[model samples]
Target: MARRRKGRAISGVLLLNKPTGISSNKALQKVRAMLFASKGGHTGNLDPMATGLLPLCFGEATKFSSYLLDADKAYIACARLGQVSDTGDADGEIIHERSVPELSIEQLQQVMQGFVGAIEQVPPMYSALKQNGQPLYKLAREGKTVERKARPVTIYSIELINWQAPDLTFSVRCSKGTYVRTLAEDIGEQLGCGAHLISLHRTHTGGFEAAEMISMDQLQQVRDDEGSIDHYLLPADILVSHFAKKNLSAAETARILHGQDIANTENLTGMVRLYDPEQQFLGLAEASETGRLMPRRLIVTDETVTD
Candidate 1:
């Protein structure tokens, strides 16, 4: 017999304002225990020193979590110029320090302009990227350095928010898999001074914004007041809101639930959000070039079937 999981089968996405000094997985676990949810997962990870928007998925909502993983992200980062760290962030050991060169805002802006576009970034060793079934950070802890290939990452924008001699603050909007720490070091290199990331806070990811995020204290207060946490949860479909929506009749919905394709006369040739006639979210479907809507992921529940 299969063993059943404990806790309620809750579903939705929680935009958590993760505090600094805690890993993303730890934050997700705390929220899961508070909600007593049967399943939970984070769309992406934030380092222990990084804070801000972390979208958490529970139960059925987890099915769409991967969409956010590949989504673009925005962050405000503070980098300390003239200093270098082994881990590329403030938490790492200080490796070197140099004299800060005199630079103007115009000069800084000119330097930043070079980063706005597609570029290659070498993954840092002190990262969660795995190597031969083991995390690279683990190897780093053992004083081992491995060769990491440079990967392509796009920076949509990079703006200097503040500059205070050795400390520089900037905001960046970049594609997934970008390493902001590397960016700081690269900028420092351009100015002939070493640098390392001193702080980082993610402001946005996919369709979720930092404005919608709630803190751990706020969540606990709601729990103490016996208020439903669902009040803060956004609909799971919001993860794929960028995709076009398709409404189907009861017959079509039934056919889609059974893993069958329906004719897509509109000839939409990409992923789409599916809903029933009553507007209840079904799941996701892929529209083919041949004018067919093929079921990809479907939400299964007792209430899913309807006349």
Candidate 2:
């Protein structure tokens, strides 16, 4: 006999304003416990020292979490010049210090402009990136260092928001894998002064924004007052809202659900969101150039058509 899973089958996405000092998984677990969700996962990892806008997906939403993982991200980061850390952030030990040279705003802006567009960055040793099935951070703690190849990442935009002598704050919008800490360190090196990240707060990820995020305290209060967290959940379909949507007839919906390709009169190519005649979200389908809509990821509801 198959063993049953624990917790309720809650399904939806929670925009959590993750607080500092907790791992992303820790936040997901806490939210899962609060909602009594059977299965939950986070779109990406936010360092324990960093906080803000973490999307937690429960139940069927977990299936689409990978799409968010590859989406763009934005952050407000504070870097302290004149010091370098072993881990590139405040969590690491200070390894070196340098004298901060008097720099004008124009000079700083000029340096920031240089980082815009495609740039190569070596992954930090303190990162979660694995080498030979071992996380780099684990090797870092063991006093071992390894060579990492420079990977190309796009920095859509970087604007200096505040500057207070040794402390500088900047807002960054970049591709999925861009490391703000490495950018900070590289900026410092270019300025002829060592630096380390003092604070970081992700303000946006994918289609979600910080303004839409709820804090843990607020979530707890809502749970205590309302006795249900389902009210705050955005539909699981919101994850793929960026794609073109194709509504299907009742017959078409049934055909697609049964893993059968449907005629693609619309001739749309690439991934698309599929909806049934009643406006219920069916799932994702890929439109091939050959005029066929192929089932990609389908949701299972009581109304789902079976073979």
Q: Write the per-residue lDDT of candidate 1 for residues 1-307, one digit (tens) a residue.
A: 9799899988999999999999999999999999999899999899999999999998888999999999999999999999999999999999998999999999999998899999999999999999999999999999999999999999999999999989999999999999999999999999899899999999999977898999999999999998878778777898889999998998898888777899996777689899999898989999887789998887876645433
Kindly report which residue stretches of model 1 are placed more than 4 angstroms away from their true locations once superposed. 303-307
Count clashes in each candidate, considering only residues at least 3 apart in sequence or on different chains: 0, 0
lDDT of 2 at 31: 94
lDDT of 2 by residue, 45-103 (tens): 99999989999999888888999999999999999999999999999999999999998
C-alpha lDDT of candidate 1 relative to the true structure: 0.92
For model 2, the local distance difference test gives 0.93
RMSD of each: 2.0, 1.3
Q: Rate the local accuracy (lDDT) of all candidates.
A: 0.92, 0.93
Clashing pairs in 1: none
Candidate 2 total steric clashes: 0
- Residue pair clashes in candidate 2: none
